[model samples]
Structures are given as structure tokens and as C-alpha cells.
Target: MDAVVIGAGPNGLVAANALADAGWDVLVLEAQDTIGGAVRSAEVIAPGYVTDLFSAFYPLAAASPVIRDLHLEEHGLVWRHAPSVVGHAFPDGRAAVLHRTVEDTAAGLDADHPGDGDAWVELHRQWTAVRGPLLDALFTPFPPVRAMLSVLRTQRAAGLLDLTRLGLTPVRRLGSENFGGDGGPALLAGNAMHSDLPPDGAGSGFFGWLLCMLGQDVGFPVPEGGAGVLADSLRRRAEARGAQFRTSSPVTSVTVRGGRAVGVEIAGGGSVRARRAVVADVVAPALYGDLLPRDSLPAGLLRDLDRFEWDGGTIKVNWALDAPVPWRAPGLAGAGTVHLGVDNDGLLEAAKDIALGRVPEHPFLLFGQMTTADPSRSPAGTESAWAYTHVPSGLEWQPDALARHVDRMRTSVEEVAPGFADHLVGEHVQSPALLEEWDANLVGGAINGGTSGLHQQLVLRPTPGLGRPETPIEGLFLASASAHPGGGVHGACGWNAARAALATQRTGRRLRRALVGTAWERVLRDPRSPR
Candidate 1:
């Protein structure tokens, strides 16, 4: 193969498609029987009820230029926006809804806390000024030096200073500084919880701003059929461009020669050569430990891998409900997604507990009513709801323990949304271990690959080096969510990796040939013996 992509996850598929589009003969290898990894839709509970295996909502899908330019809708993919972007409910029966329209959302905020309407409007206005440049900096290949320069040039001196300050502050501090009301802080904290980070963590403010602004700019929407349909469409487009997919082929190793990746060794002793490049969409730790030979990796890289912290694990529960969740607050019944807890303080407490390796008594639960978002997800008059909560990583995943936790989550939701547990017709719970088994990228149910903390984001992602998707080894790249731009179904990581690979291929092909003899001699004469 001209370019071989290991793991047919969304990022892998996107990378393969990009390579194929650039006229490379691409091959995608997947360990599972199905092609899509986390982006899968199946009738897990009932015959007709379809549930998204992992990711359901796609706020990034609407905002991703790579996905947008692909015209996935033309390829049988449709997007359906929810009536309200999201809802955050409190224990005391108070709820706040973020609407698709900024004005409406501001009004909702004002209703909740008297003067928060103007505060929200001001926040949105500030976000609008920097949103384009910020997104461009994030989504595009890094060392985003050019994008940063452009942003600096465009914004006035004071605006630039404000942006800098916003980037540095934690979500809790940012909310406190920007808006005085409880509603503003609650909304900001809710948005920040989308990442594994706590609201008080450094740089979490950026995530809060980014997600809330995205919700306002483009409501969190799901694919018409399910999240899998989006992947299917990408597969179709890639296949049309001459990309080949091999299912159930798990890669065991990436074959190296002269310190360069030459091919991959499959689990069953089969090998496939990559004539040009090997793009791995797998998580970083897995790739280094399982796929590559230790001798091939630098000592510094291996040491850094030891320090890598996978994000907290998740316990996911999907339910086939007889009816929509009856919220104590009536307006929340129509929400597509809901964040349930007491308030911002309660949410922070939950996050703190999870970080300390204990499941919170009142876990910050994120619930999605798939049927409300897209009616096609369930049978008529029925609803499909899924809820997930972050748990400490590396915890033993026992079925009985999982069931108990599920019950606790049920009770938590019921406290906010009355009669929630009674409506469950069928339930499916996936423990962290189960999630890791399903998709290796979600190592121990760390959905975002690595923690979205300040040290692990943007340029420092996957490791501190060139953030432009290139690896130290020639013709190899990290294109997974572990790379720059982080997680979500957006193909930015893959797209950025493909573009980098193309650039490297253009320049390195000739340069590599010239240095082949010297490189081989150096490889053979190395003092380090192969284990």
C-alpha cells in the first residue's frame, strides 16, 4: 500500500480518505468486524431501537471544515439539530437551556438570573471576534505560528490582551470574572464538563468558551440516521477514491527498517507493507508500547510515555425508555442533552471526587435523549436515552459493581427528572474495560485519549515536539485524537496528518534515497541491541 492506516476509527478513515484523495493507494485496517470504531450505531437493546455505541452528538461535526467540505450530506449523511442546544438541571428543580439562537439563550439566562442576559451577549460578542482565528489555530496543522500572528494582527492591542488572559484562566475563574450571576457560572461550568477536566483546572476556561460558543454558533446535532451514518458516508467517499478497508485485522507491530517504518505485522502473523507511510489513529501509549519496537523509539520518547496520563474512565448506560424523561422543570423535557447535578458547586465537587479515585455520590451525569434529538433513533412514541459519567481510570470493572453504579446513576437522574427509572424498558451498561475492548483508542474508557489539561493540549499533545502530526520516524504520523485539536469526531487530526505526510513525502523521498546507505550503516552499527 502507498499509505497504510492502522485502526479504522473516524480519524483513521479520514486520514485514509485524505491520502486517497491526494492520489495515494490507501489501505485501512480495522480490528473489529465493523469499520467505524466508536462512531457505531447498533440495535443493542431492542430490535428497532438504534443506539450510538459511543459518541452520539456532533458539535465538532458542524464546525469541522474537513467534515463540512466533504459534503457528507450528499453521501447519505444528514444532520438534525435539537430544539434547544443543551439543558443543565439542578436538584432544586431549576434548569437552564442553551438555545440555538444567541438572543434566545441570552433571554433564557436573563430569566434565570436578572442581568445575565447582557453578560451572555457580551461574552458571545467577545467569542465571535476570536472564534474564527482560534478555531483555525486549533484545527489546522500546528506550530500554528502563522495563525497566531494573524490573530494578533487582526485584534486590537486590548482585545489581544483579553484573549491572552482568557486563554490562561480556568473556567471557574473566567465565569466568576465575566458574569456575576449563578446562571452564567452554571452554564460555563456545564460546558467545561464536556472535557474530562474540572472547572477549576487551568485552561479549562478555553474549553468552556469554545463549546458554549460552538453551541450558539452551531447547535450540537446528530447525524440523521445515527453517528455511524457519518462514518459510513466518509467510508463511501474514501472507497470512491480507491481506498481499501480490511476489517478484523489488528495490527501487532509496525515493521521498521533503517529506523523507518516499512510495514505492519498483523495479529495472526500476516504482514502488509506500506510503500510510503503508516498513519496510526490508535492512542499514543498503545502505539508506542504494542506496535513499535522499543529500540526504534528514542529513550526520551519512552520516558515521556511513562508520564502520560490517560483521561478518567467512563461508565456508560443506554436505556430504551417507554417515554421521555419527565423533568421537574418542564422546559427541560424538550432538551436534546442534559447535565444533571445540584449546581456549579456540586458539579465541581463531583469532578474533584472522580479525580481522587472515588465515584462521586452525586456524579455529574450527562444525559442525551437521542430520540428527542432524532426521532428515527427509536420506535414511535418511545425514547432512547443514554447517560455517561466519568469514573477514576484503572478501577476494576466488575459486572455487579457496574450494575450498582448504574442504579446509582438512575437514582441521580430520577432525583432531577421524576420517574426516570420507571420508564426504562431495556438497559445496556458499558464499563470502562468493555469500552477499552470495543475501541482501543478509548483506553480504559478515556474517551478523549488523554486528559484535556493545559499541559496535554495543543502543542504539547501526545508529547512535546512538533505539533504538526509528524512523528520522529520517517513516513509515520500520529493522527488520532491524541494529537493536536484533541478529541471529537472531527477529522482535523487525520486531515492535518495527511497534509503533513504529503509534504514530507514530497521532500523526503529524494532526501531519504540519498541518505539510505548511511542510514542503514548507522542502524546496523548502533550500540543498543534489539530486545
Candidate 2:
């Protein structure tokens, strides 16, 4: 094969598709019998209900350039959105809703904070100016000169500095500064918690703003039937392009010959030789620390790998409800995704609990209403709902303790819907240990691949100076969330890795280098540049 992608997760599958589209022979190896690592959906909860077992809502998928370019819709990928994208429903029956258009969303915010409507519109205006290029800069490789230029075309250097501040701003500050109350900030904080980052952390604001804006622009749409449909579409596209997939074929190691990745060794028996590239859709620690031999790695790189920290754990619960959640805040019933029973203080308190290794009694919950978005997820008059929250890692998992946590989580939901428990037909829990066991890629249940804090981001992602996907070893690249642009359902990491791998062939690398180098030189010559 021209390329051997080790792991048939979204990133790996997308990378294989990209390679095959470019007319390369690609082979994708999967550890499990299925594809879609954490993106999988199952009827694990009850009959007639298809719940997203891992990742349910996909704002990133809706906004992804690669997913758009791939045209998965033609390949049977349909996105379903609720009337409202996201809602933050507090205990007091006050809700902050994010609608499809900025105007509608702003008007919703105005109810709590007067003129906060204008603030939201202004934020969206700023997002419009640089949204395209900002996403390009984020997903593309480091030193993305073209992306930088695209943003500069719309925004001045000062505006760029402001954008940088959005990334550096704490999530709490971002919400408070832009609006008058906790409604807006709660919405942002809830979304930011999708990462391992705390609301107070730097760069958490970027996640908050990005998700909030994306939710407004394109509601957090899910596939019609289930999340698996999206994965199946990706697989079908790849297969049509002549990519081959091997399920239950766990790769033991990358066959390195003379410091270059040659292929992969299968766990039980054979080997798949890659004529060109070996894309590891696995996490960074597993790639550098676990797979490669000691001598194959440099001391400095190993030390950095040792310092690599995994994100907090997660406990997910899925339910088959006889009816839509009877939210105390009636507005929440219309939203596709609802964050139940919490405000900013509650969010911060949850984060603090996770930090302190104490399970929160009233855990802040990220609620998803599957049937609200897609009726196909359940039978008529029924709903498929799920909620998940982050927990501290390294705690010993006992079945009883996990059960207790699940009970608390259930109580958190009941706090919102008041007698929501009476509507449940069936329920299933996925603890951190169970999540890790389900998919090895979800190491320690750090779903975004790792903690996406400021320190772990940029070139320091995975390790310092290693976020570009290209590794020190020839033919080997990080093509997963462990690479740049940390997490979410977006396939940017895979696309970027595939592009880098393609660059390794022909004079593509040289051409790209020349283009970037020219841009760098021009920027260096600019007196007003921040370089």
C-alpha cells in the first residue's frame, strides 16, 4: 500500500480518504470490529432508541471545511438541527438560548442583559470578518501563511491582537465582559467544559467563543439516523476512492527501518507494508512512548513525552425517555442540546471538584436531546437523551462508586426536569474505565486526546514543537486529535496530516516551503508586523 493508517477512527479514515482521493493505495487498520472510534452510536440504552454513545452533537463537524469539501451529504450524511442550537437552563427557570442566526440569538440574550443583543451581534460581525481564515489558520499546519493573510485582509493587526486575546481570555471573563449576566457565560463555560480546560483557564475562552459562534452560525447538528451514519458515510467515501479497511486488526508497532516508518506489524500475525507513509491516528504518548523502541527516540523527545499530561476522565449516561425532558425552563425543550441545572458558579464549582479529586454532588451536566434534533433517533413520542461530564483522573473505579456517580448525575438532571426519572424507560452508564476499554484511542478517557490547555496547545501540543503532525521519523505522522487543533468532531488533524504526508512525495514539500518562506520573508520585512 502507498499508505498504512493505524486506527480507523474518523481521523485515520479521513486521512485514508484524502490519500486515496489523491490516487494512493491506502490501508486502514482498526483495533475494534467497527470504525468511528468514539464517534460510534449504539442502541445500548433501549430498543427503538439510537443514542450517540460517545460524541453526540457536532458543531465542529458542521463548520469543518474538510467535511464540507468531502460532500458527505451526497454520500448519505444528513444534519438535523433543533429549533435552537444550544440552551443553558438555570435552576431558576432562566435560560440562555443560541439560535441559528446571530440576530435571533442576540434577541434571546437581550432578555437578560439589555443591549447584550448588540454585543452578540458585534461579536458575530467580528466572527464573520475572520471566521473563514481563522478556522483555516487553526486547522492548517503551523506557519499557515495563506490563512494569516486571509485574516489580515479582513482584520487589522490590532484586530488580530484582539483575536489573540479571545484565545488568551479566560472563559469567565469573556462571558462577563461581553454580557451583563451569567447566562451567556454559562453557555460558553458549558461548551468549554467539552474540553479538559477549566473555565478560568487561558484559551478556554477560544473554545467557548468558537463553539458558541459555530452553534449560532450552524446549529450543533447531528446525523439523522445516528452518529454512526456520518462514520459510515466517511467510510463509504474512502472505499469508493479505493481505500481498504481491516477491522479487528490492531497494529502492534510501526515497522521502522533505518529510522523511517516502513509499515505496521499486526498484533496476532501479519504486516502491512506502506510504500510511502504510515499515519498513526493514535494518541501521541502511545505513538512515541509506547510503540517505538527506546533507541528510536531521542532523549529530549522522550523527556517531553514523559511530561505529556492526559485530560480529565468522563462519565457518560444515556437514557431512553418516554417523552422529551419536561424542563422547568420551557425554552430548553426547543433546544437540540441543553445544559441542565447550572450557571457559571455551578460550572466553576464542578471544575473545582474535578481538580480536587472529589466527585461533585451537583455535577454540571451537558444535556443532549437526540429526538429533539432527529425524530429518527427514537420512536414517535419518544426521546433519546444523554448527558456527560468530566471527572478527575487517577481515581480508583469501583462499580459501586461509578454507580453512585451515575446516581448523582441522574439527580442533577432531575433537578431540572422535576420528576424526569419517571419518564425513563432504560438507562446505561459509560464510566472512564469503560470508555478506555471501549476504545483504546480514548486513553484514560481523555476524549479530546489530551488536556487542550494553553500550555499544551500550539507547538507544545502533544509535545513542544511537535503539533504539525509531521514527526522526526520519516513517513510517520500524527494524524489524530493528539495533533494540532486538539479535539472536537472536526477532521482537521487528519486532513493536515494527510496533506503533510503528500508533501513528503514529489517536490510538494519544497514548493510549500518556498511559498511559506516567501510569506515569512514578506512578514519579516513589514514594520507593523508582530513578529
Candidate 3:
């Protein structure tokens, strides 16, 4: 085979498709009996309801150039959006809803506070001014040289220093400084909490602002039928391009010869050779320690992997409701995604609890109304809904404790939607262990491959001096969420890896391999150096 992809997740599928599009022979091996990793959906909650097992909304996917350029829509992928992108409900039954248009969203915020709406409009203006280049920088490879230059070129059009300052600001401060009301601040802080980052953490402002702006640009959309439909669309596109897939095939380890990846060893007792490359869509720990021989990796690289930080653990609950969620706030009814049961202070408190390794009494819930986004998710008048919350990483999650945490999530939802539980016809809970069992990439229930914190991001991701896909081993590449740009359904990691492999093929192999090895060695020599 020209390339052997170790996993059949979205990233792996994207990689296979890219290599195949390049006219390279490609084979994808999946450990699961079925493909789609976290992007798959099923009717486990109820006979008529299709519940997304992991992720539901796809703002990132909708905006991703890599995913969009694939034209998956041509392969039976239809995007559907709810009337409202996101809704945040207050305790007093009032809500802040993000509409597709800036005017509508600003009008809603203006109702909360007179001048806050104008402030929101200005924020969106700044985002719009630089959205293209900014997104390019985000999804591009590390050092993002050309993308950064594009962003710099916009300095005259948009205030470069001001954007830089805002990007580095904490979400808490970003909100307080920009708006005069709860609506604006709640939206910013709530979106920031979507990740492992607390509202006060550095760079939280950028994430929060990015998501909020994306909601305006492209509504938080979903597949017309189910999330699995999106995965299937990608699969169909790859297959049309002649990429082969093998399910129930687990690659136990990557075989190396003379410091170059040659093939992968299957679990039972077989091996598949890769003439060109082996793209691994697994997490960092599994690749660095479990799959590859330890002696093949530099001792310094192993030490850096030891410090690899994973984001918080996650617990998801899926429900098939007999009726729509009886949200007390009328505005929340039409939103595809909802952030509820927490205000600015409550979000901070809950974050602190999770940081301290204690489950919060009222965990903030990221609830999704699948039926709202796509009516086909369930039968007429019924709803398919799910909610998830994060807990501290490395918790035991014993039976009783897990149940209590799940209850806390339910009760939190009930606070905003008075009769939420009463409408449920069926319920399915995915604990941290269950999540890991389903997809090993979600290690310790972490949806993001690794922490999105500043310390572990950029060139420091996976390990210092290695954020791009090319690994220490020749013909080997890391194409999982653990790679650059962290976690999202964008498929940039896979795109970068495949492009890197193609670039190496065009260039001479020995010279490129020697240069890469020397670069890693030079940067890794000083463990304390951030560079």
C-alpha cells in the first residue's frame, strides 16, 4: 500500500481520501466494528430517535476549508440549521439567543441592555474584518508563516495590536471590558466554558469570541439525518476516490526498519506494509508509548510525552423525549445548542470545582436539541436531545459517584427547562469510561486530544518542537486531534499530515529525514526552553 491509515475516524478517513486523491494507494484500518469514531449516531435511546453518540453541532466543520473543499455535500451530506444558533437561558426565564444574522443577534442583546447590542455589533464587525485570515491562521500548520502574514497585511484594515490584545485577554475580562450587561458577558463566558479553559484563562477570549462569531457566520449546523450521515458522506467521497477501508482490523503497533516506518503489525498476528507512509489517527500516548518501540524514540521525546496534558473528563447523556424540552424560556425552544444552568459567577465556581477534582453541585450543561437542528432526527413532534458536562481528569467515576454526577447534570438542565426530565421517553448515559471504551482517542473522557491550554498549544503540542504532522520516524505522521489546532471536526490535522507526506515524497527522502531529525534534536536539547 502507498499509505496505511491506523484509524478510520474522521481524521483517518480524511487522510485516506487526501492520499487517494493524490493518486496514491491507501488503506484505512479501524479497530471498531463500524467507522465514524465519535461522529457516529444510533437509535439506542429510542426506536424512532437518532441520538448523536458524541458530537452534534458542527460550526467548525461548516467553516473548515479542508472539510468544505471536499464537497461532501455532493456525496449525500445535507446541512441543517435550527432557527437559532445558540441560546443561553437565565434563571429568571429570560434568554439570550444567537441568531444567524448579526442584526437579529444584536437586537436580542440590545433588549438586555441598551448599549450592549451596539457593542456586540462592533465585536462582530472586527471579527468579520479579519475572519478569513484569522481562520487560515488557526487551521494552518504551526508557525503559520503565510497565514500570519496574511493576518498582518490586514493590520491597516483592522487594528492588529487591538486584535492581538483581545486575543490574549481572558474571556472574563473581555466580557466586562466590552459589554455593560449580563447577556453579552454570559454569551462570551459560556462559550469559553465549552472548552476545558476557564473564563479567566488566557486565550479563553479568542475561543469564546471565535465560537460566537462562527455562530453568526454559519449557524451551528448538523447533518440532515444524523451525525453518522456526515461520516458516511466523507466515507463515500473517499471510496469514490478509490480508498479502501477495513473495519474490525486493529493495528497493534507500527513496524519500523532503520528508523523509518515500513508497516503496521495487526493485533492477532499479521502485518501490512506501507510503501510510502503510515498515518496514525490515534492519541499521543498510544502512538508514542504503546504502538512504537520505545528505543526507536529519543529519550527526550519520551520525557516530553510524559508531560502531555489531556483536557477534562466528559460525561454525556442522550435522551429521546416524547415532546420538546419544556424550557421555561420561550426563546430557547428553537435553538440547536443551549448553554444553561450557569451564570458568569456560577461558571467560575463550577470551573473551580472541576479544577479542584470535585464534581460541581451544578455542572454547566452543553445541551443539544438534535431534532431542532434536523427534524428527521426523531418522529413527528418528538425530540432527540443530549447534554454533556466536564469533570476533572483522572477521577475514579465509581458507579454511585457517576450516577450522582449524571443526576447533577440532569438537575442542572431541569433548572432552566422546568419539565425537561418529564418529556424523556428514553435515556442513555455515557460515562468517562464508556466514552474511552467507545473511542480510545477520547482518553479519560477528554474530547479534545490534549489540553488546549497555552502551555500545551502551538509548537508545544504533543511535545515541544513538534506541532506539524511529520514525526521523528520517516514515513510516519500524526494526524489525530492530538496534533495542531487541537480538537474540532475540521480535519485540518489529517490534511496537514497528508500534504506533509506528499511534500516529502516530492523532495528527496534521506535529506528531509536528516533535516527533521536534526531540528527535533536541537530544539529538544533544552527541556526548560519553551522554544
Candidate 4:
């Protein structure tokens, strides 16, 4: 095969599709009994209810150029949206909602706080001005020279200095500076909580702002049937182009000969050869620590890996409800996703607790109303819902501990949606360990591949190396979210990796590989080096 893509996650499948579209022979190997690593869905929550195992909503996916270019809709993929994009439910019978349009969102905020509507409008206006180039810069590979140049050219469009200042400011400060009340600030802080970043963390303002604006632009859309359908569409499209997939085939290691990835060793003593490239959609630590031979890896790379930080562990609870969530705040019923059971200050407190290795008394929950987003998620009159919260790392998730955490989660929900528990037909709890079991890349249930904090993002991601997917080894690329641009449903990570692999073929292969090896050494030895 021209390429052997390891781990059939969305990134891996995207890499396979891109390579196949390039007319290269491609094969994808999934360790699990099924495809769609974190994007899978099943009826495990209850009979007739389709619960997304991991990620569900996809505003990022809708905005992603890589995913858009494939036109998955041609392969039977359908996008569905709830009436509202996201809602932040307060303890009181009030909610701050982000609607599909800026006007509606602003109106909601304005009703909550007089001047806050204009503040939101100003923010969205700034976002609209820089949206194209900013998204280009984000989805492009590290250094993003072309896209950055485009952004610079459009600086006057949105005031580059002001934009930069907002991007660097902490979300907590940004929200307060712009809004007169907590309603608008709560939306920003809640969105920032999607990452491991705290409300006060530098560079969190951009993430919060970005997601909020995207919600207004595209809405937090989901597949019409289930998230798995989106994955299946990608697979179908790739298969149409002749990309093959093998499930239940776990790759033990990447076979490297002469410091080049040549093939992969599958379990049960089977192996597959990749005549050109090996794109691994696995986690960075697994790729460096377990897959490759230790001797072949740069000592500096291994040293840096030791300092690799994952996001906090997550506890996800899925429920098959007999009816729609009896949300006291009626505004929340229309939202596909809800940031519930906390306010701005509460989110900050929870972040502090997670940082201090203590679970929050009232965790900020990222709740999804699946049936609200897609009616097919469950039978009529019922709702398929899930909520997840971050906890400190290193919890054993023993039965007693899991039960307690689960109850804490339920209580958190009940605080907002009064009769939440009464409607539960059944529930499924996925501890950190269980999440890892289903998707190995979700190390300790830390989603977004790794920490999305500024310290660990951009060029510093995975390790202090070039944000590009190319590793020190030739013909090998890191296509997982651990690469630059951390997490989300967007396929940029995989697209970047596949494009990098293809570039090797067009360029002088030997010379380029040798140069890359030299650059890798310098980067590994001195992360600050610009060799």
C-alpha cells in the first residue's frame, strides 16, 4: 500500500480519504470492532436510543474546509440543527442562549442586560471581519505563512492589534471587559471550559470567542441520524475511492527500518507494508513510547514526552430520557448543546478545583440534548441526552468513586432541570478508564487529544517540536489531535499530515527527508531552536 493509516478515528479516516483521493493506495486499520474512534454511536444507553459514545455536536466539522471539501453529503451524510446553538442555564430560571444568528443571540443577551446586546454584536462583527483569514490560519499547518499573510493583509479589516489583544486576553477578563452583565460572559466562559483551559488562562479568550461566534454562524450541528452516520459517510466516500479498512486489527507497532516507517505490525503476528507512508492517528505518547523502537527515537524527543500533559479526566453520563429534559429555563429546550449548572464564577472555581486535583462541588457540565439536535436519536417524545464534566487526573474510578461522581453529575443537572432524574429511562456512565477502553487515544479520559492550553498548543503541542505532522522518522506523520490545532471534529490535523506525506513524493524525497531529520534533531535538542 502507498499508505497505511493506523487507528481508524476521524483523523485517520480523513487521512485515508485524502490519500485515496490523491490516487495513492490506502488502508485504514482500526483497533476496535468498529470504525469511528471517538465519533461512534450505539444504543447502549437504552433500547431505541442512539447515544453518541464520545463527541456528538460538530460546529467545527461544519466550518472545517477539509471536511467540507469532501462533500460527505454526497455519500448520504446529513446535518441537523436544533433551534438554538447553545444555551447557558443559570441556577435561577434564566438562560443565556446563543442562537443560529448573531441578531437573535444579541437580542437574547440584550433582554438579559441592556448594553450587552451591542457588546455581542460588536464581537460578532469583529469575528465576521476576520473570520475567513482567521479560520484559514487556524486550519492551516504550523507557521501558516500563507494564511498568516492573508490575515495580515486583512488586519485593517478588524484592527489587528485589537484582535491580537483580545486573542491573548484571558476569557474571564475579555468577557467582563466587553459585557455589562454575566449573561454574555457566561457564554464565553462556558465555551472556554470545552478545553482544559481555565477562564483566566491566557489565549483562552480566542477559543471562547471562536466557538461562540461559530455557534452563531453555523450552529452546533449534528448528523441527522447519529454521529456515527457522519463517520460512516466518510468511510463510504473513502471506500468509493478504493480506500480499504480493517476493523478489530490493532497495530502493535510501526515497523521502522533505516529510520523510516515502512509498515505496521498488527496483533496476532500479522503485518502490513506501507510502500510510501505511515500516518498514525494515535496519541503522541503511544506513538513515541510504545509503537516505535525506543533506540530509533531521539533522546530529546523522549525527554520532552515525559513532560507531555494531558487534559483533566472526564466523566460522561449518558441518559435515555422518557421525555424532553424538563428544563425550568424554557430557553434551554431549544438548544442542541447546553452549558449547564454553573455560572461564570462557578466555572472559574471549577477550573481551580480541577487544577488543584479536587473535583468541583458543582461541576460545569457540557450537556447535549441529542434528540433535540436529531430526532432520530430516539423515538418520538423521548430524548437522548448526555452530560460530561472534567475532574482531576489520577482518580482510580473505582466503583464507589464512579458512583459518587455519577450522582454528583446527576445532582448538578437536577439543579437546573428540576425533574431531570424523573424522566431518565436508563443511564450509562463512562469513567475515565472506560473512555480509554473504548478509545485508547482518550488517555485517562482527557479529550481534545491533549491539553489545549497555550503552553501545550501551536508549536509546543504533543512536544516542543514543529507543529507539522512530520516526525523525525521519514515517511511517518502524526495525524491525531495531539498534533498542532489540538482537538475538535475538524479534520485539519489529518489533512495536514496527509498533505505532508504527499509533499514528500513531489519534493526530492531523500534530500527532504534528510533535511527533516536534521531539523527534527535541532528541535528535539533545543525546542527554541529555529533551525
Off by over 4 Å in 4: 526-531
Query: Worst lDDT window (10 residues) for model 2?
Result: 522-531
TM-score for each of the candidates: 0.95, 0.95, 0.98, 0.98
Comparing 3 with 4 on lDDT, the higher-scoring candidate is 4
Count of steric clashes across candidates, in order: 0, 0, 0, 0
In candidate 2, which residue ranges exceed 4 Å CA deviation?
A: 508-531
Residue-by-residue lDDT tens digits, candidate 4, 65-153: 88999999999999999989999999877899998888888898999889899999999989888888888889888988988888788
Task: Give me the candidate number with maximum lDDT.
Answer: 4
Greater lDDT among 1 and 3 belongs to 3
C-alpha-based local distance difference test score of model 3: 0.89
Which stretches of candidate 3 lie above 4 Å from their native place?
526-531
Candidate 2, residues 240-273, lDDT tens digits: the string is: 9999999999989888888678999998889989
lDDT of 3 at 160: 91
State the C-alpha lDDT per candidate.
0.85, 0.85, 0.89, 0.91
TM-score of 3: 0.98
Q: What does the lDDT read for residue 462 in candidate 4?
A: 85
TM-score of 2: 0.95
| Candidate that beats the other on lDDT, 2 or 4, i.e. the better one | 4
The global Cα lDDT (0 to 1) of model 1 is 0.85
lDDT tens string, model 3, 1-531?
A: 999999988888889889999999999999988899889999997798998998889999999999999999899999999999999888778888888899999998888889999999999999988889888888888879888888888777349988988888999999999898898888888888888998889999988999999998987999999999988998899999999999988999999999899999998898999999999999988998999998778777888888999999999999999999999889899999999878888888889998898888878889999999999999989899999998999988899998888888888888889888888898899999999998989998999999989898889888898678888888999999999988989888888899889988988797786777678878666454322
